[model samples]
Target: MSEGLSTRILDHIVHLSPPGTLEDSADAFRKLGFTVTPGGTHADGQTANALIIFADGTYLELLHFTHAPPASTAHPWAHKPPGWIDYAFLGNAGTPSVADTINRRAAADGSGVRYAPEVRGGRTRADDGRVLEWLITAPAPSEGNGTRASARGRLPFFCGDVTPREWRVPLEPRSNAEHASKARGVAYVKLLVLPSELDAYAKELTSVLGVSPAASSASQVVWELERQPSDSQPYQAPTLVLNAAEEYEEEIYVRERGAGIYELGVAVEDAGKAGVAYTPYGRVVWQAIGSR
Candidate 1:
């Protein structure tokens, strides 16, 4: 467990589009009032994601396959792991031993999910010779009941080494930008419920994200943005909840394949204005969800 990555809080979450094609979904996101950036092929050469920037260092990444099916040998996350998505937390110099610390914390929480966290980090130099560093994976099980961090694990904690001061720059884009998405930034995200696992899922998230779960009525839990760390003024790590009832099985299955939303949120400045762009999917409104 090395220190030096950022884990300030969740800066963003990711949604993996279907493998090999996301133009439609990308367009859909664009219509949702976001400035969608281009994505490139992964190092393992399996998928890609268009990123949505927030004023905060955090952003939302929509990943999907970009070419021929990736060989099984590619990175598990890049192979397009199953689930609605993945999320990125802040990491910086203060977060050394992040992998180890979180694993230990989880186990101490007494949820009984045991596993150790592994790392896939490397160092590369910037043009000026400064080393750009990054590392990620689930918190080690020792920190969280010794559970293994597997591909598509629910609410896996993301620890970062980057400090709040150093994140003023924009994230790198994977592809090109279209004019339509220029004004876009993350407004917030909504997690449609995983009710069957709501309590357990919320508990896991609290451990990983360092935030308590919100109470629910009708299985719909909404997290309101409190501190807008970014220019968009959206809360950091703001999450939305939907009823994940067995009653809604078909809808969940259609969206998740077999699982539920790894995470869900949105990018917009004015929910009212953005509603027009979102009408095709469902009713759009600046629905008020209280702060936690």
Candidate 2:
């Protein structure tokens, strides 16, 4: 494996809800000016999802199970709560794969960030019969010891497409990406963690993403994605922010749901025009493009 892994782009964020709430979740996002496309059931036949694709190749997945899986199933969603439960980063196609590098670096750093071996994952489009396939590297299962486990839901997994990327993300009739709210793409994803766990989680994330923390403080730590500066293009890749939950005014989700995704920052042409609304899942913050 290379001393350091190649940069991994943000692929998508997963928003999980209870069964039979898929349509309502789509409707809620549609009301917020996103174009929600119909997603089909997972290959496991346990869950279904709807996708909100952005122009930047990043997307938001609204997932819910068609019916609960058997009690013996060990999928992550089987016991997760209703909210932004997980997220994934794009991975390379060859060996020592991105997952390998992540686990390797985590082991070297002693950050306790490890993932299960890559596995095949796929789904058939509900609108059409087309099939989509990919390889996923999920967090390794916990050993019931006091040691921190990646399966607790703080770290992101990796996804590498077996089929062409464009096939999974179609680009046709620009209208598919357009929205009523003038929203463009994801700006950043904010995660909440207890102040005590901030340093450990930051180290774990740094090792997993193969990126260094840009800024850190008692309140929060920020990791900005690496992107070349350009005069022609102003929008940069999305960022990942880990905030201390105790600093917040209201209830911190981490208190209820462990360390996990808390808020989604979306980029819009005009924040004023993009009205703020709370969904059954979580909060969405609309910000003007290029704003910090």
Best TM-score among the predictions, by candidate number = 2
Lowest lDDT 10-mer window, candidate 1? 279-288
For model 1 the local lDDT of residue 140 reads: 34
**Scored by CA lDDT, what does every candidate get?**
0.46, 0.77
TM-score to true structure, per model: 0.64, 0.90
Which tens-of-lDDT digit does each residue in 159-224 have in candidate 1?
A: 343423232224444232222433333334444444566666555555554345466664565443
Candidate with best lDDT: 2
Per residue, candidate 2 scores C-alpha lDDT tens digits across 234-279 of 5767889998887554235677788888888888887575545577
lDDT of 1 at 84: 47
Query: Scored by Cα lDDT, where does model 2 land?
Result: 0.77
Residue 83 local lDDT, model 1: 35
